[model samples]
Target: MKNELLSLLNKNLLAVEPSLIRKFDDEISKIPGIIKLTLGEPYFNTPDHIKIAGIKAIIDNQTHYAPNRGIVELREAISEYLRRRHYAVSYDPQEQIIVTNGASEAISTAMNSFLGEGDMVLCPSPAFGLYRNLAKINGARYIEIDTEDDKYELTPEKLKTYLDEYHTSVKMLVLNYPNNPTGVSYSENEIKKLAEVLEEYPIVGECQEVCVNG
Candidate 1:
């Protein structure tokens, strides 16, 4: 029965390897008195105020499942935040905002929604491994454009070249900013240039921003 169940599992899943980040973190964690910074682990504890509010919610019996998109209050707050930070960008809370558990869920949702079998996900090299794993799980091919020679930044010219080469199979572009492993970010002008290149293609761009605070 065990062998039969294993055989029935998705081959794509079986082909996926464990995350090297987590593996390294686990190994290094065993060393005493070492200040480890792997796996995006937070250095600070949860604030007292937030902890109290969470306890209060449980006491008030507000533990039922939230709306599929998320609570309206939270979504509204997110919309307002984007509006304030981006100056000109605004999202409608009721129709456009979705509050995900974390970046992982949000990325998974976007990839599953846009990708199909044999589709291609173009990722910049040295990105978070989750993007590549998720693409494989969705039966899509993950292609990396090495950015080591370009100061670890994916320029518009490089992006356009890859798109042209894999135009047919490419359906999504995965971009990470304040990029993991490299800690590099694109300037405003750089973003605009890439956007101009992207405008000519039909691919969906999945951009991940790393925020320390929830």
Candidate 2:
């Protein structure tokens, strides 16, 4: 029975190597008194008001399944949050937002949505490491672009080189800022430069992939 099960597993299951971040964390945890600068677990707890809201919602029997995209109100909040705090983009809560359990789930879901077997995803190397795993899990190839020389950034020249060299087949590109390991970040000018490169492409959703580590 065990042999039969093993054979079935081999037939059905594709083995993917686990994340380098997770591997590092597992090894680091075993070392006594080792302070991990490896995985980024937010030091601060979720604010009290947010926690209370979750508790109150559950108590109020708001436990039914939400829309596949997520709760409308929550999505709106996310949209507003992004517009108010970071980017100039606005999204329709009903159409454009899908909340997952966490950022990890979000990345995994996005990869699953955009990628399939033989699809190539461009990732900035010496990255958070989880992005590579996410791409792999979707049976997509991870094409790592080394951004080390450009202070770990996605420069216009770099983007141009990849787009020119790869020529249309490569669809997804992931970026990270206030970046892990190096703590490097893009200034406003740099952000605009990257955005300019994106603007010139005009591929609609084809080349629009930016995943910030923060």
Candidate 3:
């Protein structure tokens, strides 16, 4: 039966492994009073106001699927938040904003929109595994740039070396800032160095940053 099920699975999933974090957490969960947050197992409860608002929404028959980009009100609020935080340029809610289930889905969605069969996606490893999975699911290739030797982040010199070696076209490059599980971030000068390397390439990327939920 297990063999038969495997035959029906997507070919792209054949080589994919379940998340190591999730697997370890599941194993430890059997222990008495074990708690984990690596997979975002929240230890806190939902706030009362949020709970009441959700209940009220359900009672008002608001359970229908939202717009493809999600609720305009929420999107607008997010746009405002980004502006308030001075992360980047402010976006128009109706024209630019989207509300995703979480950062995972958001990455999948964006990759699907930009990647196609035989496309190449440059992703630095020692980060989330989902980025690779999403690339496979989109019929694109995931080029894992090992960043262990480079301090868990891609360096400009390494980027240049890969680019020179490949000379192969890249459809997209995924950079996860304030990365998950490690919470590694780039300083201003480090970012400048990376930008200098990328300046040589013709790249088209949306600058909107997705906050990975944990």
lDDT of each: 0.86, 0.70, 0.75
Instruction: For candidate 1, write residues 12-78 as lDDT tens digits.
Output: 8887889999999989999999998887768999999999999999999989999999999998988
Q: Estimate TM-scores for all models.
A: 0.94, 0.80, 0.82
Error of 3 at 157 (Å): 1.9
Candidate 3, superposed: residue stretches over 4 Å from native: 1-10, 86-88, 204-214
How do the candidates rank by lDDT, highest first? 1, 3, 2
Q: List the residue pairs that clash in candidate 1.
A: none
State candidate 1's TM-score: 0.94
Residue-level lDDT of model 2, residues 87-180, one tens digit each, is 7778777777778887767666666677777777776676777667777767777788898898777787898787677746665766666666
Best by TM-score: 1
Flag clash pairs in model 2. none
Between prediction 2 and prediction 3, the one with superior lDDT is 3
Q: At residue 12, what lDDT does model 3 achieve? A: 76
Pitting candidate 2 against candidate 3, the one with the higher TM-score is 3
- Model 2 ranges off by over 4 Å: 1-15, 199-214
